[model samples]
Structures are given as C-alpha cells and as structure tokens.
Target: MTNEELEFNNDEEVLTLYDNEGNEVLYRKLLQFYHPEFKKEYLILAEESNFSDEDGDIELIPMISTDDEEGQLLPVETDEEWDMIEEIVNTQMDEPEE
Candidate 1:
C-alpha cells in the first residue's frame, strides 16, 4: 500500500478506512471498535469530557472476506432481508437526541 492508500483521515465525524487496493472496506462505523477496552472513547473525545488527549495509533487486525476471494456477492433476493439490513444500518447511524 502506498502512503496515500494507508492514510486514515478523520476531518469530520466520519472515519474512512481504505484497504491495500484502495477500496473502502469500512466507513464511519463508530471509533469505539478501534479499542474494545475503552467503550465510547470517541464520544468522550467528541464531548471534550474527561478523556485522554493522547493520539494513539490503533491497528486493526486483517479480516478475510469470503466475498473478496470468491467474488461472491451477498444473496439479497427477498425484500425482507434487504429491509432488515437497512433497518439495522439505520439504527446504527441514528444519534441519540440530548
């Protein structure tokens, strides 16, 4: 991967992760997954609460995608399955109103 390909920038609230091939594997899926030990660390940082200002680089373990190797796409035949996934994604994207 080149310098630009491995670069991860978080200008806004969105976090974009790119693969070696310059394909976006994951995007804006809550930075909480970056470190499992500390829950809602990103939220705390965003709120500027009692959060550590230390900018530590977190490395993610490589995940083997079955579809990537086999070139197989997810079977989304029925509308129900699509709706279910859509609902789940929507729920994740929703922010709690204060």
Candidate 2:
C-alpha cells in the first residue's frame, strides 16, 4: 500500500463489514494507527450497538491492512500479531479519559 493509503484519515463513524455468510455487521470506529514494527496500518473498532457482554463490556475488533481499498477489513492472522494488537488495546484501556 502507498503511504497515502496508509494514512487512513477517514472521518466516517460507522463501518459495515460482511460476514462469511454475506451478512452485514456495523461497527463504530474506535481508533486506527500505523504499526511500525509490522509496517501495517491497523483499525481498531467496536460494534455499533448498545449490546455488551454479561459483564457489560463491548468487544473490540482489530483489523489489518488489505491490498485493496480502505473499506475492506482483514483480521489479524498470527499469534504474534494478536499479541501486539492486544497490547495496544490494553494500553488504551489503561489510559485515563479526559
């Protein structure tokens, strides 16, 4: 991907992703950042709904870069990748909101 494409400076709040059965799922964008270690841009998102876990926690989805346009969302493929992404999420959760 080009440097410009990697910017991911999108302003859209909701993103629609299709499931394997061709169902559409809407997600709210939480954050997006470039991973220098993996040389990839990652998009972190949460489902756009009032639903939560039994403990009232919203699940975060981590998406990796794709060869095509930015609308496409690809999941993290490896254990190492998941670890890195999880670390980022943990750090974000540990931060104090202003």
lDDT score at residue 41, model 2, on the 0-100 scale? 79
Candidate 1's displacement at residue 26, Å, is 12
Model 1 regions more than 4 Å off: 1-71, 95-98
Give per-residue CA lDDT, model 2, range 27-79, as digits (tens). 87776778766888788888777435578788888888566765566778999
* Global lDDT scores for all candidate models: 0.31, 0.73
Q: What are the models' TM-scores?
A: 0.26, 0.73
lDDT of 1 by residue, 23-56 (tens): 7553322322122221111210122221224664
Error of 2 at 46 (Å): 1.8
Worst 10-residue lDDT window, candidate 2:
1-10
Question: What lDDT does model 2 reach?
Answer: 0.73
